[model samples]
Target: MDLFKSFSTLAKAVPLACLAFGAQAETWKYAIEVSQGDIQDLYAQEFKKRIEAKTDGDVKVNIFYGGTLGTSADATELVADGALQFANISLGHLGSFVPEIQLFSIPFILSENNEVNKHLMTDSTTVYQGMEKGFAKTGLRLMSIYSEGEDAWAANRAVRTPEDLNNFKMRILVSPLQVEAFKDLGSSPTPLPFGEVYGALQLKMIDGVGQPISSVYQSNFFEVTDYLISARHQLFTSAIITGDDWFDGLPTERQQLIRDTMTEVTHYMMDEVPRLEQEFLAKILQEKPAMTYISLNEVQRDAFRARAEQTRQKFVQMVGSHGQQVLDGFLAERDRLEQQLN
Candidate 1:
């Protein structure tokens, strides 16, 4: 049977959907904080539009974007604490609670187009039905997942290989697996909140940052970092979350509306985010003819690939046996979805 089938069965054992079409007189505050004028800001605005239309304004989703709510780790923790109701959390922040989320840090695991929908909606989805039950005690409900392509580097210097990344202190979201991998690369990595990046870079507090080109462009980091290098170093994905107890109180129809709507948003984002990123970057450079875009040689890329495998091994060891099983199932589902994409 397919992974979705398994998910359906699992969801059925939990609660029925399709009973929550009506809107409730509730106010919602969401945090998306990735800065204001970059590529992600555009897509985030679109998502807000959909949510508004879906609820017809009865439910308001206030965006505490650009660190008004908190950074990646704080977003997850606040949602769990119920201090915040909704958030867009990076998977790498899983170090705070779900270390298995680290398995995706396995280098080139998601560099190709084949990885997009691979993990969005399968039985091995981001947070499993039973596993999510654990979050109930913490007061959070893992909601929709949106795919992000592999992350690259934004630096002041040209980086074509992992060796080049050596001694390159970069700012990465605080994750034990990622921190160690960067440390192994001969670079000093300091884990910090996303909100602190701009000032840090401006102050020369760090040397470089590892993120997708889209984010770099969206957050206007290209303004600070003169070089944009496609290291395709790591594949990253994100999860949308809400309070678990709050989610359970919603009617089935309302629940189904979100499930179906976000599924559409997922596909939309998969195509739109990347497409817009290219346009934005092009316009950015065209406007700034003095900027540079570094191209990595094939041999160097392969060297980077070698490091990817080593990183994956580290993740498996770091996450432990139970975490490995989750990784296996997620990869299996990811491979299947890749076939469909191909």
Candidate 2:
């Protein structure tokens, strides 16, 4: 009778002990190297919320925003090495590590229709799959890929045609494709770090910077530049990435949770981008009435597109045959989806 009572008591206490130990939750740190008011910051905060709630606090996300960790490049390195668990990285920053990524940055590669964003999300999209596969080889998993809007020209003078771009020194991302594309378009592409761009523009070191309207608004470039031309050139694609080793180490359910949560965030950002573009443009119009905001007509847009096409081979040569295969697959898928949409 005494032994039976003792065994029953021990079994009851086992549950309590398990609960106590289980209280120690799995924690992760997410790093964002951009400014606070940007869309990526918003996505990080919401991502934290969703992960915690969905996991019922079993998993916790700690967000370090505004380069609290380090510069964007530093953060990306940390994430790739698994020192940082997650990061939101611009495609340009990723090209050096995964040359195949440079394909997406090629000028005028993506369609203007917002639905093109949605099409890339499908699992069967060849280029998207290829990029994800390529990223895997570099030890990074691409959780989400979406547009933050298109790149625009923020110049001291209005740039209406290719001639206007001649002799113009423009700030570009560090991607070679960007340099080649702008060079073909008759501008002197000056690749500069994001931090140096504002001072460079103010000092007339560079004549203009190419970025999205949201970026111009966030970076306060509108105060320094007099023209905003909607190039819609290069749909700026960004990816949410995590270290493959770290992700793979997680429980299967946790992996799925993160993937699903990020997918939801990507879709939300896609819808948010155009609206934010309008918001930023409206603010620019109201505050800087003298700033010229020009939207290109079909003929002008075609001219820019034709020039961009000339840079495609340059990108292919940079990445070689494998990269060309990815580009061809993406173009075919893009065309197929576009036709279905029409």
Give the candidate number with the greatest lDDT. 2
lDDT of 1 at 193: 72
Q: Tens digit of lDDT per residue, candidate 1, span 1-342?
A: 699999889787654444354435566667775767553455466667887788787766667776676566677778776667778777676555767656655666553663445344323554466357555656776666665544667777777766776678789877888787776555678777776776777777877887766677666677777777775555557777777766667799877766666666666777776676577668768866766877667787787676656676677788777666666666676677677767
Hey, what RMSD does candidate 1 come out at? 11.7
How well does candidate 2 match the true structure in TM-score terms? 0.91
Which residue pairs of candidate 2 clash? none
- Reference-based lDDT, residue 255, model 1: 79
Query: TM per model?
Result: 0.82, 0.91
The global C-alpha lDDT for each of the candidates, from Candidate 1 onward, is: 0.67, 0.82
Residue ranges of candidate 2 with Cα displaced over 4 Å: 1-22, 121-124
Q: What does candidate 2's lDDT look like per residue over 67-174, in tens digits?
A: 588887888878879998998888888887888777777777776666765667534356556677778888888777777777888889888788899999999878
